[model samples]
Target chain A: MDNPKHGMTLIVKTITRLTVGLILLFGIYIVSHGHVSPGGGFAGGVIIALSFIHILLAFGKEVALKRISYNVASFFESLGAIMFITLALLGIGSGYFLLNFISKGEPFRLFSSGLIPLYNVAISFKVGAGLFIIFVILVTFRLTKKDDRE
Target chain B: MLELQILLVFMIIGAIVAVKTKDLLSAVIAVGTVGLGLSVAFLILKAPDLAIAQLVVEILVVIILIRATIRKDLPFSTSGRWFFNTFVVFVFLIVFLIFGYICMKDLPKFGEPIMKVAQSFLNNGLKDTGATNLVSSIVLDYRAYDTLGEATILFTAVIGVLAVMRKVGRKK
Candidate 1:
């Protein structure tokens, strides 16, 4: 499969790879240190989505689409929404809307946050899948040959 | 101070590039860069909550722009509507000036009494909420309603995408 063109070159490819790796690592750092630093699930998730966008720009939309199909991405997005809502319901039981760690109070530890970690994971999945789906749809529309249009 | 100046310069460049770019996709990305810069600035100001909100909204806006305009050619040049551009610039300048003044005046001093209050809240409240993460407590307990609203906004965006991108005869 040949790479589709969108001004991608070898330098772009190399930079994209390095950037994606760095973004993923940085995202983990952000989420893990969210309690102490200026980062959390949303920021981490956006960083992760950016990694996918870098891949799309470097490797082409076809490679990205193949790696994660639209259907699967949609499923993950919906699943994340469901999980978030479920957690919110759990909070209602405790007179809150998404409270976690009511039972286990482990402060100053990564695993200490009961639902925080789970929320981060859910958000990451949702953000990644949502972004992938959006990119695929947009790029697919953009890349279709003019002659192929109805 | 130097880092702040550099960040401000980069932010201005990103915003100008986003507004002036001809290519729609590049413009979208330029706008994203602006948002990214603002989020970083938010971190510097110790407003992580606002930063997260900014990032999430930025991503959603980018997605919506892509979905809406991907099929059309992104026109870089308008007929140079001078009056409209001037009006926009004037409004932007006024807003920026006001915000800049407010920020300078109302911002808390670094390492002040408020920091201690904030710290004590995090230190003591973490145990009661079962969340070791101070940010998580801020998000899920102290301000869970805002988080819920944010999630709903995303959900609405998903539904909007479904409505716009749906093909004929596709089952809902």
Candidate 2:
């Protein structure tokens, strides 16, 4: 049996690892700078998705799946969604939903956006988890089913 | 205007490519690029919130498409009726032209007085609502019901996906 890692030559492996690392770092940058810049939760989320895609393409779906299981991804997605909705419901007591019912402590500070930062965090988690789950489920079908050779 | 024109051209190309592609996977990717273009346009229009929402929704839609396509056997074909395709293209052009004309004619100027009013509300209304983010204040407090409905939609989608993808004979 050929090892899955054998699928990629040394150069390819190095490039793939570098690409994945850069993409993940870029995603974090986008998410953190969301309030101050144009890139926010959604852009950051897609960046993370691209990172996962790079890993899958470079290392194969089986390796990626092993690192991030379908079940765990789904659970993270569900949990993120639940957390977002719960934050919204907290607004209902004050006659609104998804309301940042907190006070903006200061201007132009990381924590100054009140619940905006928190919301961004939640959205990032939801987008990342959702995309990962989708990719896993879709790619699993292709990886698992082998052709019958007589 | 030049940049906008270039972006518009790219968007048109992406859309046309998406429509003409027969391979489901490639088509899906083209569609995603088109969506990314649209989101960029939204950002240029100074609607960051809408842009973010568009990006997120587009990602979700593309993921859904990928999952659906992977499960099914789809064949790619380049052959189709030319006249029918031309007719569809003509219809799309006419509809889009009219829509663009209306938008150009009637849309509010960016940073209009109403926007200032909204900004003031966010500035002052935070104290009353006890909210930090102006956007969040607008979304959750001023339009709580809308947020609830949006959340409900997400919940429904989650339930639907779970139901469709659930394994058979798996008892709780």
Candidate 3:
């Protein structure tokens, strides 16, 4: 806590900067490949959120907030929810809540799944933004002994 | 299977350490270790998806605990009614063991299940959902409503956190 400005040691910061992008890329790959891979929206979204939080930990709070402002995170979350609801509603044509209305493509290909990939994307958006907001909120309202000292 | 048993032992040790540790940080670490062990167990159980989800949830849980215990200190040795608590726990354990034993006769055999739904999915998941992965098809197509509910839950939780944490009349 000597130098609060630098959130962590140089090694952590360097490592974080190097791997954050890779983590983010991996998360995207997982989300996009949900129809074929073991991971889907939830796991990939968590990894994406972790990447942002990693940036926050390696750098300071201010820097991380700058990259994903509160408004932007809120927007992503809302948009994801709306998109999901709309997709479900669109299934009304097929007489179900979330019927895969879109014609199912050839199996085993990236573009095969009817609506699963889209749903995965929506879920990822919701999860990633929600997780980041939870982290940000917790960090902001963190309990401290500073009041007693003052 | 042997590796899984070893990890389960580690998990049990970690659980005991978490329960018995005086320091909150040590307790968190011990619980996290148990989480890691559980993820490994999931991997051994042939569920990489579960393992990934468990690992991520474990990390998020540690973060939440760290936030909650920033300056709070709860001593492990502060209880004076330990005997009463232990007695109650033992009573509950015995009751549960007896009940489980009674129910065991009716339990299905291990490694074999009446998996009609699973068999159908295995047979026609790709044809139905055009997804090669049966897990994905089941999650997003067959159980899309469940997925929707999960997303809604996350959305509501974030809104709850925002309502609790946001500064009044202050835009940042």
- Tens digits of per-residue lDDT for model 2 on B1-172? 5777799999999989988777778889999998999989888877776787688678767876876776455575548797899899999999999999888767777455456667767668656544444555565356656544654565466556556555666553
- Better model by TM-score: candidate 1 vs candidate 3: 3
Q: Name model 1 segments beyond 4 Å from true.
A: A1-29, A36-38, A92-97, A143-150, B1-40, B47-123, B130-133, B167-172
TM-score of chain B of 3: 0.86
For each candidate, the DockQ is 0.34, 0.21, 0.78
Pairs in clash, predicted candidate 3: none
TM-score of the A-chain for all models: 0.76, 0.83, 0.91
TM-score of 1: 0.67
> Candidates' lDDT values, in order?
0.71, 0.69, 0.86
iRMSD, all candidates: 3.4, 4.4, 1.1
Candidate 3 wrong stretches, greater than 4 Å: A1-4, A142-150, B76-80, B169-172
TM-score of chain A of 2: 0.83
* Top-lDDT structure, candidate number: 3
Question: Mind giving the per-residue lDDT tens digits that candidate 3 earns over B52-156?
Answer: 889998998998898787676755465688889999999999999999999987877756777977998998887888887688788888988788888878778
Using DockQ as the measure, the top candidate is: 3
